[model samples]
Target: MAPDQTNSADVLIAPAPGPGALRHRLEEAILGDIASGRLAPGTALPPSRTLADALGISRWVVTEAYGHLVGKGVLEARTGSATRVAAVAPVAVPDGAARRVAPAPRLERAPDRATHDLAPGVPDLRHVPRDAWLRAAREALAGATNQDLGAQPPAGHPAARAAVATHLRRSRIVSGPDDAVVLTRGAADGMSRIAAALATAGHTHLLVEDPSWAALRDAAAAAGLTPVPVPVDDAGISPGRLRAEAARTGARAALLTPAHQFPLGAALPDERRAALLDWAREVDGLLIEDDYDAEFRYDRRPVPALQGLDPDRVLLLGSTSKTLAPAFGIGWMVVPQRWRAPVLDVSVRRGPAPGPATLDQLTLARFVGDGAYARYLRAARARYARRRAALLTALERELPGARIGGIAAGMHVTVDLAGVRVGPAGAGGDDAAVVDGRDGVDAAAADFAALDAAAVVREGAARDVALVDLRRYQAAPSARSTVLVVGYGNLADARLPAAIRGLRAAVEAASAEAAGAGAGAARAGPTGAAAGSVG
Candidate 1:
């Protein structure tokens, strides 16, 4: 509340008591006073009936408000001592900026959601055919070889290796498979192997992608390789820049996701693909091709695996991150003949441990070899198609004009909101409703705000309908509006509409809040002038 000419800043909103109005207003006023410190925490509030008479409001209204406060523990309403605030410190206001709402909070926490969860890499669970899995499990236990289960095998399951080799040759059309496939954990395991191999190859630097997976950048640095970022555009990293960077840093290997790039969602094009292979051939450098989530193509026909084009230069890496399950931890690295020993040696130095448990490998091999893997792949493709369609439709309806980026292949997609306007409170908060129009958040500024979250990434976790405050995945500090990287993997088709409704509610509430805050600040600032502002 801002004072008009008299330099007084006080706002009192008390509705006349007709029925419930008095009770509501009184409660609001009491809470407001307690929050603003007009009525100090320890101060005794007037007894219900007595205060009601004095204030000309009904005795029950005053009692009701006091009762409400007492319930909140704001008032003790003790048997002897006067009503007092609870001993506990002031907790965060609901949906208010009192605490941090980051990665997980902003993420929709419900698991066990979605039918065709095709937001990239998640395999069709329908393919599991529970009955088959159960049978395989029984068989695995019955036929348990004398292999130690206390620690993992250095080389993965011989049967799994053989199965993978057979699958690769038939499906990916790779050449001979009568060689070593040192399995560690997953693709991540392979990356570690490559990192170690590159270090021993006497290469001090690793050429990287600009908008690549955050994991790759971390892996390179962990392996003692300087990650020299090579900016990637649609065609993938310009071959010219790749050559220059490799020459500049003597980069030993380039970690890439050619078939389907991460984050930016670029599927490597023909010319660039050939040029990249040429660069590797010319420099005798290694290319770690992450063929992680290439199986779930929706909009276009499946792109051919790059490893088939140049087997020697490209160490094709594959994982079950999207195929089976992340928990299964099944992955493999296919190294060229000469580098096979070095790859295995690096794995040994790093305590080469096979990931997917022997039992799991046995099960997966059964799943794959029994033609169920292909069946699940086909099923997953269909489910993801629906999920993708739902996402596109929602964006089209709610956030019209949002530039949907990324190759229409994968579990996640990005929406660029450069043209739209979104504020800090999000679309569902009412903080801005009290603003008097100047420009700021006085209510927030006067009391508290945790760390300035403007520095972190948010909203890229899972797809939600209410995306008003989703600015997490956007390039930082540009104020390029708010972009949302939505993962459709977790949403059930039936629940999406409700999610969109939630998004709208969040944004609408946010708008009202912003207005109110602006108004409230204007009523209380700059020596009682109309100096209110809200963000």
Candidate 2:
């Protein structure tokens, strides 16, 4: 057992030969070392030639073993870097042990510190416009008046509101007076205020998109409003379904990501928009529009803000979480004139406004007014476009059968693994379970065994690739698809191929595990079977 020569500091013990093909033995030994934590995640391995020479084996044997492990995502190799153990590895389980389900991942938590994180809603922090931001901060501080440093109005500083109003009008086609703009810490903060206002207005039920961003649901619940999930589809939330849900649940307020629906990524068409507006007007309901990442649309010009169609019924929310960085802590809501006082009152009751410091708000005002923000967006769009292209290419090569959704725009895409036919009883077969009219898929129709999303997530995590199961966002179990919301915003273009390959390995493993489980269930008698039969 000698240390590797390439990186003299890191040690590598030569694996002993066993009774099998040299390559098989070598592969097994390496896997054993990795499983035993002797070759820890990210530990560099000796060059194949060095290991082969030291072990008195053919160099080809070592190379084949290393290649096999790389294909399995147990290791990673870069052109200019040494072959090393993957950043994430599967936890070792005893023989005959059952696999445990992983807990659903949260959207607000920062992604795990991993080699590749594909968690939805994470933005690329590397490209933040430091220079322009610093310039704006300096100008804001230099021009600050004593009043600017004092307690500010609940509606935000006049200059900042004016700047935001102008930007929304020019960019999102959301027209409103500066007074309509109410600043808050971020979209989450704005949502809280809106929820409180809805609660105060005697609204007990709020209509929400099924499989929507989880934070909005949390906000509505915190305000003592029950959230009733309305199904979404390829054309965005169906107006008919929403109307029906609202009528049944007596929900008078709804939150939507109409520009591009979060997770599933469907832009609401003009027709659906009109219908939704009509429904809102008929019910005298309120609509909260979260325009979280509208600025990053690559396929075409971004969809116009839903609020622009009828500002009186739509409270448009925008945040710098995506375009800039979450650390900026700035967001705005274009409130309806009638509800402005109620929202502000709720803000006051909650104590002092929880918005960013006045100086930071003023700096954003300057940033937007000086044309710096536009230039930054131009650069960011191109950067993200390239990263997105890389991710799509990798998925095409690695997982050809994966049905990709939400690729037209947004920070993430939905990968439907259940659409992939793995065997005779594979998903999307005649027996495929479908959710009734939910996202245009049958929920109870699957005849095949359900693929465990937890298994897929666990496998991806083992390879140091963070993934979010789409089921995490669902208010109810409505479908059998093991869909994953894969975010590429935080991932580097250079790493996409390896990350996707690792994900492919995870999907294949999960598919095989599911097929095996299905077979076992078929063989089991009624007495041997589990009590519950999930569709």
Give the top-scoring candidate (TM-score): 2
lDDT of 1 by residue, 1-535 (tens): 2112211111222332224466765665555555555555455555565454334346676667677767766666668755554544253332221221111343444454332232333443323345556676677667767663446655677777777777777766665574656565788777877887778878788887775666656776788788888877766778889888888888757878887777667888889989998988888888888887788799876787788888888888887767766666788887887788877777666653546677877766676777777776776778778868887887666544457778878777766543322344333134322212222344534222111112112221133332322333222223433444556654544445555444434433433444455456556665655545553
lDDT of 2 at 198: 86
Candidate 2 regions off by >4 Å?
Answer: 1-112, 419-450, 519-526, 529-535
Q: Scored by Cα lDDT, where does model 1 land? A: 0.61
* C-alpha lDDT of candidate 2 relative to the true structure: 0.78
TM-score, every prediction:
0.64, 0.74
Give the range of the ten consecutive residues with the poorest summed lDDT in model 1. 2-11
Which 10 consecutive positions of candidate 2 have the poorest summed lDDT?
A: 94-103
* lDDT values for all models: 0.61, 0.78
